[model samples]
Target: MTRGWPARLSSGEVTLRPLARSDRAAWREVRRRNADWLRPWDATVPPGSDARPSSFGGLVRRLHRLARQGTTFPFAIEVSGQFVGQLTVNNIVRGSAQFASMGYWIDQQHAGRGVVPRAVAMAIDHCFFTAGLHRVEICIRPENTNSLRVVEKLGLHEVGLAPRFLHIDGAWRDHRIYAVTVEECPGGMLARVAAPPETG
Candidate 1:
């Protein structure tokens, strides 16, 4: 298992650190403000499912448990010292298949400006180098142009499409799978995203 967990990763002004109970108010404010903006892309509990809704405290506790088990790494995305969003690496697999899936959301006010992309690059770098993970995957709804753009900017390859991949926005939705292996970004994801574009 990875020794250090609940780690802090940063790239420029964007930082990814463990979400804490103390962040309750700030996290709630961002979620409330972006509720409408995020509705279409947010994951929802399927109707009639046995899963109970989780309160903020419950959610944080669960994330902490997962982190201790080395199965998940949850992060609060902060920009220049302000909480603005979340990035979670979930469903980690070890042994011969060292892989994980990543999911994220940002406050509408912080959308674009390369915040999410920078945060993602930092997280993936940590997963590969620090966590001893191989590949990382991000599944995005086709209609979510904003999320699709992040993977595009980072040059993550589109692996395929998954039908009814997840229950999101009140229904099972298809998602386009985007992934990057450590081999794909040998120098590190942060460096790749930070490098200036080449001109012919």
Candidate 2:
């Protein structure tokens, strides 16, 4: 029922597109393969949690509904045209506070190639330049060096730490909040990554 939302965004070597029901198989395979690798960071319900495990069909439905409400952009990250992982722009806020939170996971195979950073840069750029949003933020567990590097490369300013910020893999986790505003990136986020590393 949601009409005219273009499902694709591409830049450099990565592309981000809306996650669909048709991606179930690809999603499952990647998730299964990365289960052990990603379990520690997986978002899961807390102890004695009554939350039901999400179903693929139900997830797609919810994502579509959220998209219709303009509060989330659930996407699949692809590189060289192969589905690799997921990056979601969630907790979108409008009105006086135009901001959203980002969360992502990439296949272990793709972890070190700058795939996540490229995809993240594209998502934040779209949120600011095209979607008319004012701010974007990414929260990472302090021990998550990989996730930390993504924001570090993008130069997202670390705002502060939130104690017990999000439940992950069955327990509450602390998070380092990193954020950027439209006032900071007048040109674009992707443009910054694409810029040559300054040499002294």
Candidate 3:
């Protein structure tokens, strides 16, 4: 069954919605402005030969195709009506291995402001509750302390490391894998946020 795209989710400070064609300009601007900061962490794509359409259009087309294939779900992170970043749950697998890998990036200006964690919590909730997935995995480069913190804050445990797990920024990079099962997250992410903190 084709799971319709999720409605916009909000956590008071950040909101997420399905990316639209109208967002191309703003998204491209955010990307260009954060190019240096994002390049080190983004997936590398081959250079295009023809210039008929801009790279942003090509990217939108690619995402639309993936959406139709049910292998990917992508969202634009918006803060106060501006596109600030992107989030994705890709490589969705069903049957015995009902899971997907999650990834995200934020505009440098929005970093360290709890934007990612809120957006991630929203995404994980959708994956487990709305999408009916058994588990979600987040793989991060060991050097990405910020990403590690985001997962840790969400209560996902480190499963293991995969050598040369992904081709990022042109080369194969090792990644530390972390995951949380639906059974382990019965109450969903919102529950974690509402639960009382533990005292030592």
Clashes of 1: 0
Clashing residue pairs in candidate 3 (N, C-alpha, C atoms within 3 angstroms)? none
lDDT of each: 0.92, 0.89, 0.84
Clashes of each: 0, 0, 0
- RMSD list, candidates in order: 1.2, 1.8, 2.8
lDDT of 2: 0.89
User: What's each prediction's TM-score?
Assistant: 0.96, 0.94, 0.90
Q: Mind giving the per-residue lDDT tens digits that candidate 2 earns over 124-178?
A: 9889877888999999999999999999999899999999999988789999999
Candidate 2 vs 3: which has more lDDT: 2
Off by over 4 Å in 2: 1-4, 47-53
Residue 142 in candidate 3, Cα distance off native in Å: 0.3
Per-residue alpha-carbon lDDT of model 1 for 23-94, expressed as tens digits? Answer: 999999999988899999988889888774388888899988888898999899999999999999999999
lDDT of 3 by residue, 73-171 (tens): 888999988899999888988788879999999998999887888898888888888878888999999988989988877888999999988778878
Q: What 10-residue stretch in candidate 1 is worst by lDDT? A: 1-10
Angstrom error of the Cα, residue 137, model 2: value is 0.7
